[model samples]
Target: MRSAAADRGAVHRPPCRADAGPDDLETDVEEIQNSVYWHDTEPVEVGEPLDGDASCDICIVGGGYTGLWAAHFLAEAEPSARIRVLESHTVGSGASTANGGFVGLTAGKVLRRLLWYYGREKAAGVYRTGARSIIDIGRFCRRYDIDADFAMNGMLQVVTDRKQLARLELQVKRSERTGLRGSFKLMGRDEAQERIGSPQVLGALRTTGALVNPHRLVQGLARVVRGQGVDIHEHTPAVDVRRVGNGYRVSTPTGTVTANEVVLATNAWQHSFGQTHTKVMPVWNYLMVTEPLTDAQLDRVNWPGREGVSNSLSFAHAARLTSDNRVVWSGGRWYYFDGRDTGRGHIRNAAAFRDLRESFARFFPAWDDVRFSHAFGGPIGWSRTFIPQFGRLADGVVYGHGYTGNGLAPSHTGGKILRDLVLRRETEYTELAFVTVNQPTFAKGAIGDTGAHLFVWRQETGDRLPLMLPHQAALAPRAFFAGRAARKARAADTGR
Candidate 1:
């Protein structure tokens, strides 16, 4: 599963001077490879593209984690059913391989909003389901012998400033009050420093989480799906999807796939389809991976557990160590292009790379001498509610998108929900909090683009000037109610 192409022909350069300011490091982006580090770790053997029209019992678009997981689950549940997955690019080349690989609760970040809108019981149910999904993914990897470097190391939600500490403490309290007493452990400055060794971290909330080589996990899952008699056609994009005689016909560049049931598993690209165009906004996020740390450099930090760490800001920064010991840092301000553009032309944002490098150095001064070997960006499908949505478009079509940049574990949960929907079964997955007939959507056209920019500005401003502004929690109610109003408006128009 290794190839010479994995090298990417990247030329390493000398590390930026430790004394160099953030502005000085911005010009050093050329030293990094404009590629995904995870993808370069292994070779992906793409399946042949479809040369002719095809028909199957189930047709799945987008061969990322969600689509592959759905195929794997459906094949096991209905061994004789025909399943086909259509991928626009090579499998797992989308956000699945572009993320920081911090597998944690999907709704954990929005727990307060969930409690405000969906009651404590339902919020807890979503949180519990997320916790179980993490374990289930580990089991799935072992069951299929997929060596994805899965580790159940907990995650740290550390606060970098005093203003953020109170919000972190509130989250811990809410978790306990929601019947998850032992799920989150609040750590003071000393305890938090022991795990992260960052002077800026005043406190943290350590919670159940895991890490994985997302590329390996997704590629191995695709292999398992293929072994189970599921057809995966790579480099085959779904051009359009239309209804046809109680089924759906998905048009592709190579051919067409008419199936009795269709699963729209394309996350960020879901906006390209009319059925889901307004349902999600594709926002670009960037990441930079440092060259492997030397033993001496590793000793400079006290992170023996190698836990994934993230800050408490609205546009937070997250850092995690890869299996090979490289630090992958991500998260800053997210960008939304006009006209909902998600093309590859936007993958190399100089500003985002600069922000990531600066933040990484600030978080771990010990790594200031380490140079980045890779830098890249990808779009994440964001729903207005900051959670995933699962439901049927028509009797013959179903979709599971809107993970809101936290899809690794929840996509597994989404697979089960899609499975039950495709099989027409009333199971627990279909009854979860995110599974609804209608979810909130973003505004369309120029207004939508303006709103997206305004949201990003607010997040960045809050993180930049925490003391000068109110806590993000204070603004949560207004955002939540705005989403509620949008949902009601959508429901009214659709008469659902």
Candidate 2:
């Protein structure tokens, strides 16, 4: 087995304050600087890279959730078949563990957007698939005894500014109309504060989004799959994959893997594959975690449930409590790596870190005395549509990637979809919207890059613009209300 630490290179710390003494808040910030909270908790153990020539019944690339889950299911379905997973870095190195640990559905408005693309039945089916994925993941954790700190403590999508109130309210209405499980409910200001105690919160939409120690979850999944007779190789990057006769030949620096079937489970790095290059964008997102709050400090927040919390901004701000009582903050700002460069060096964004710090202070003024312990970033595969792209790229070549940032639950469901595709079996999983639908590929070259930049720019600018123009403060809410009313009127008129 290879040491996972070798791939991590050097540790990058946050900006230090020269004026501060050893006894001040600067120490807290430096404590967890430039490392993932989950990975820092435990040492990751991974196997050696693929050496020489190898052959398998199924070859899966990338050791993150997508590849691990696919291998787990495939090994179960065909016990006699040979299974191998090749990862470029250590297991859980990508978005799998480097995320905000949000186990949520890609439903909400994305469900409604599906209605526009597909019909009502298909849209509802798509929404239900994602909703059920949340349940399926929790059940798997319990059944396998993977103690990843699985918490079904629910999540709160709060609106900090008045401009966001209508949007939050509309989501509640949409969830009700879409017949989502009885989990999503509109909360008044007082109720929202009781749940999260953030002064910026005006209202919230509460739903059963689980929180987990993502690092533990992925590590556990890898362990379980390996126990079931799956071979996993770390520090092995699949440099080239080409069709050879009835199977595909995957070349790596250390060796070559020829398999009857190949599944590309690489997420953000999917762009490196010619078949998926234009189909996904490898963009980076940032996160920061605070030092463990004191018992007295925890009381000031009043969140006994310790639910996951995120605001309703387009470039939304999200925060969740860890088992150790530290708050992990992410979003509010994201960046695009011009040429799909997901090198480890690109993971540190000083600007994104500063923005996250300022936003955290604004949202939780009561925590002024508190300082962050860690700050880090990771790449997320963004499809043209903010949903995942799933299907068979060619015979025996199935691919799953691009969950935007909501990969935890979706990846579990996607894994099953890949299994069905690999086995050439038609089941409910094969008919789901994400698997059956054709996702539009992003424009290649400068056009696609420019569009991606502008999309991110619009969200960042929109969130900050209101502060500059007090006169336009009420416009967003009014516009949202007007749109909601129009949708309601159309539904009533149709009487369907």
Candidate 3:
């Protein structure tokens, strides 16, 4: 099992704290509706709810990858278990579908951090669980006859700067110390250039990973669970859940569901629940797909092959070639920490876009001038600790969230883990690191926005300090977080 932590590191080192580009544009809902990810083509289309109150053995919320996969695993574990899924929107509508289809396996420095915080045994356990989850995803696709273009192509961690090169050097050594799958193999600048077919590439640290069309994959999983006789209700949002004896009573707008257990798969939408917890909001992650390159331009990138790759530069980016011959890429920087929209949650501002255009032209001069076919942007969630926060929110209520920017395939793994938790299965998934409790203080919309803006600004745009410089940088915010959590704890004790 690979570590699921690759994309789940802390709010990225080069945090997002720049001024908002002066513009306000409505997101293209039509683009979202007409996406290749979700088209109405399922064998048993349960687009509507059961029409009234219903009872199931388990009720799952949110139809994104997490909820759907949870339903699949539950049916697999118990063929006769009565499972019902409730989704707020159409399937694959959220981050599950729109993310850059990179199933990141080489959990960058996540393993390194785990070894530092917890002992080797505990950290290794989580890594094993996470790695196996990736393997499980591939296996499940084949088992369920999913054709979301599952590619076993690994990822290349591009190294651009000498400082970044040194970071990779330390990362490689750290991985070895923490028992990485293979030796940290470093490719030279020329070697990286030749291997990735990009002349601008200096060096690379490649690792075993995968690239899957995330939306297609989740849609396929949704189909498989229906084949198993589980009931799924799309456009159904589970708004509230209260413990009823040994089970729960979940409420929706027009109906309610009584279940012995409930799984909360709504990562970004969890705050809608009237619970006092640290929540992740919509942080628009802007993405764009270039038109398929011409033969002459293709030769410049020579992408050798279509594989997922992200570099270590500040506000670095990740890219992959789609089956349609389009290049899909994502920018690596966030704007706020308190979960507010920063310039509509953009990856590239005008200045940044100009530089990005230059970089593209620099790497693949042919692509430099190619116009984008479509641009998509939305939010991805993250917890304070960076890794996913998954566990029982209460008795008979288990949920997971906070993948940050790099969820892709790892969220699938979390799906499996949450399934095991629901079924009480004692597999290797048990030993993995889980953060069930990170009590957070309450902040109104105004205060939350203000604090988040100020903190992120100081961490990112402020030249006085760096966001991630060992212990020196985190001292202030960590203390702030502790204070917030303590305040939350006190409030919970009194109010609840």
Candidate 4:
């Protein structure tokens, strides 16, 4: 088997940074294409679109991880059942190929919210499930001979300032109380810096997370699914879905699929349907990849474990090394258009790319000369509760989505949940906290747009507040998040 990192070679280097203006930064990326680095790693054979009417036992709408995983599991469970996956573009062309490829465990704000809503046992169940998903993905890759650069090297949730440090301390205490003491190891400033050579890292919480080449993972999974007799159609967008007798009819641009069961696995695009319009909010995230680092450049960072690193802020930044040694830097501010627009037009935002470049320079000043080779953006589904939700929408229609930003590993759990729901089984997956009947939805129209803007402002502002200020200066935003969690928990309990 070929190693995922051994194939790629370096490109031309750009001018080094020296307090350069925005124009100079623009020059650095001027020649770079707005494309995902993962997609360019290898060539993919695109499948044919649906040409006419079709029928299947199970129809999955979305060829990303969720849908592909669901098909894989369903095929394993019921070999006689016919499964089909519909994709708007190519498989894994959206967030799956564009995200920072950290197969993460639930942590930071997401874990906090899970603990608040569900008690310790339930929250721990979710964590355990997430952890198992990571292992399961590795096993699946090995079983299918998919060389996705699967490395279970773990991840570090670092604090850049004193305020974040305080918050990380509290989070550690909470995790300890929740019986997850062994899941994370707290590291002081020096120890944290040893793992990751960054002066900004005040403290770190190390968790058992893994990383993978997401494009290879998804594409390999699609091939496995197709080999298992599942039909996958690329460039076949589901235009509409409606109830037809005992089944559901999914209309696509060129054909229609009538199936006994339907799975709405279109992560960010789930908002396009009425049943999920308010249930999911589509937010755009941007990422940039640098040219492959030289041995000396890698030695400067001294990231021997090559663990994925992300900060502990509401609008956090995450960095990880690709299989080919390029640094993938992502996350600063999430963008939401005035309307819920998930079009190609929003994929390349100049402002977001500039912010990403500047933030990367700040975090790893040792790599001041490293130039970015690729920049791209994609939409991710953000639930109001900040966790993924999957259950039946109607009798024959089951959906799984709202992964927020971390879906690679959990989507494995989601596939099992979806499989059980479609089979009407009362298994452990069906009892998971996020698998529910009536999940909460965000506000609609102008209210939702305004609220999303305000939420982003609060998160970014909280992260940007000076450490010299009093601790109380950051209390307002913290309180806001806490209050919202409480309200969401209450609403979920009351089925509102």
Best by TM-score: 1
lDDT of candidate 3? 0.63
- List ranges where model 2 is wrong by over 4 Å: 1-32, 107-109, 464-496
TM-scores, each model vs. reference: 0.91, 0.88, 0.78, 0.90
Collision pairs in model 1? none
Model 1 misplaced stretches (Cα beyond 4 Å):
1-23, 467-496
Q: Residues 1-496, candidate 2, lDDT per residue (tens digit)?
A: 1112324563544433312233543453444457776887667766898889999999999999999999999998999999999999899899998899988867355765676677667666766777788888889899989888888888888888865674565565556665663656656667778888888887677776899999999988999999999999999999999899989999999999999999999989999988788888988999987766788888888687788988888788898988878788898667896777788886667667767777887898787777565688999898876778888875457899988888998899888898998998999988988777768988778888898899888877887655433322234544544554576578668986
Clashes of each: 0, 2, 9, 0
Local accuracy of candidate 1 as per-residue lDDT tens digits, 205-324? 788999999999999999899999999999999999999888889999899999999999999999889889888999999988877778888899889889999988878889899887
Candidate 3 residue lDDT tens string, 379-469: 6665555566677764558877777666766676677778888887776564466543343433658776776566446534532233344
| Residue 417, candidate 3: C-alpha displacement in angstroms | 1.7
Return whichever of 1 and 3 wins on lDDT: 1
Span of 10 residues, lowest total lDDT, candidate 3 = 12-21
| Every model: Cα RMSD to truth | 8.4, 5.7, 12.5, 7.2
- Candidate closer to the true structure by TM-score (higher is better), 2 or 3: 2
* Predictions in order: lDDT: 0.84, 0.80, 0.63, 0.84
Sliding window of 10 residues with minimal summed lDDT for model 4: 1-10
